[model samples]
Target: MTITYQINTPLTAKQAADIFISSGIKRPVEDLARIGRMLEHADILVTAWDGDQPVGLARAITDYAYCCYLSDLAVCREYQQQGIGKKLIATLQEHLGEESMLLLLAAPSAIDYYPQIGFEKLTSAFLIPRSK
Candidate 1:
């Protein structure tokens, strides 16, 4: 499919929202302003594109040495199951180097998917659920 990957590419909120909606990924896609803010505040963005179409993406925040919190990973519905998400994570890792740890909170529906792609689930992690 000749998919291409990029780092820190300028992404519009509409494009990100479209991918989030189409990929069935849970996010605040209904609010463009929030989406724009999310993209703006992210530390890193690894995006996969087919020419001009954003097929998959990974958004992360990292200290660039100790840990990388992978906040978002999404692939278009038609683009899922093609290992694009894996490639996105791998690219993100390549950008981070081996000194950092990559971590993410998986969607309930995708609980099994991450392990198959080499993500080690942790039981000790805790979260203060969002009030919104």
Candidate 2:
């Protein structure tokens, strides 16, 4: 299987919104407008394609100096276990270089996976508003 990998920020809001919805990543359609704006501020957005089809996506929001958060990582279910996610993350790290903090919120099932990718468990506190 020949897959193409690219590091680009030209991804459109429609493309991202569609991927998020299709991948069941829990991003609501109502957020697409916000997401579109957010994408503009991203340091990098890497995508994997199978000859024109977007099969995976990984994005980072950063200051490009101090820290970067690896957000919106997803690979279509059928495309999992083929190293797509790893490739995406590795590419992002390359762009980050050294001296930058890479952070992410690991999905419950993926906690163990993050550690394997060089992320140690961090003890930090954050607040989320309760659902109304």
Candidate 3:
């Protein structure tokens, strides 16, 4: 499959919502508004499209200088393992260039995947809500 990348400026709220949910990245519904805000005001967002439909999204917040946090990355389930995710990350890395620090908090299942995409292990602090 051919993968094409597009830089979106303030992507529709619905697309952002789908990426928040379908990519298996958990976030509260209340956060959708914040995602919209980020879409409106942060670094460029790279989206992969198959025909006219959006199949993948990679969102980042970057200064294009010292640091870039790759916060949300997701591709449709039917589209995994096809190098779409890797291509998205590669595209983001190219945008960030060589000197910037690229970082993300990987989901437990995704720990192995990130390293393969050029991310190294790093110790960081995090907090999660306790299950009732």
Candidate 4:
């Protein structure tokens, strides 16, 4: 499959929700409005497309100079293990400044995957649980 990457591409909430569901990412896919808001507020968004199909996505909020929070990284289950996720991250990094650092909170199932793609495992991070 020939996959193309787009940065800051306009994506409808439904398209994003579909990818989230296909990739087994735990998101509120049923709440498209919330998803739309997430997209609206992200500072960077990279998407992988196989023709018209969105097979992968990476969304982040960054200061462009200091730090970045990579909130989501996902590739469709059928499209996994093919370096799409890695490419998406690489694309995201290209948009960030050299001084900026990228970080994310991986799901339990994805804890091992990030390290394989060059993310350092950090034990010093902390977060307040989100109430939804």
Clashes of each: 0, 0, 0, 0
Choose the strongest candidate by lDDT: 4
C-alpha TM-score for every candidate: 0.98, 0.84, 0.83, 0.98
How well does candidate 1 match the true structure in TM-score terms? 0.98
lDDT tens per residue, model 4, 1-132:
799999999899999999999999999999999999999999999999999988999999999999999999989999999999999999999889688999999999999999998999999998999999
Candidate 3: where is the Cα deviation over 4 Å?
Answer: 29-31, 124-132
Per-residue lDDT tens digits for candidate 3, residues 20-80, read 6666766553566776776777586888888766788888888888999887788877778
Q: Over 4 Å off in model 1, which ranges?
A: none
> Model 1 over residues 1-132: C-alpha lDDT tens digits?
789999999899999999999999989998999999999999999999999999888999999999999999999999988889999999999999999999888889999999999999899888999987
> How large is the C-alpha RMSD of every model relative to the true structure?
0.7, 2.3, 3.1, 0.7
lDDT of 4 at 122: 95
Clashing pairs in model 2, backbone N/Cα/C closer than 3 A: none
Please say which candidate is ahead in TM-score: 3 or 4: 4
Winner on lDDT between 3 and 4 is 4
Identify the superior model by TM-score, candidate 2 or candidate 4: 4
Worst 10 residues of 2 by lDDT: 123-132
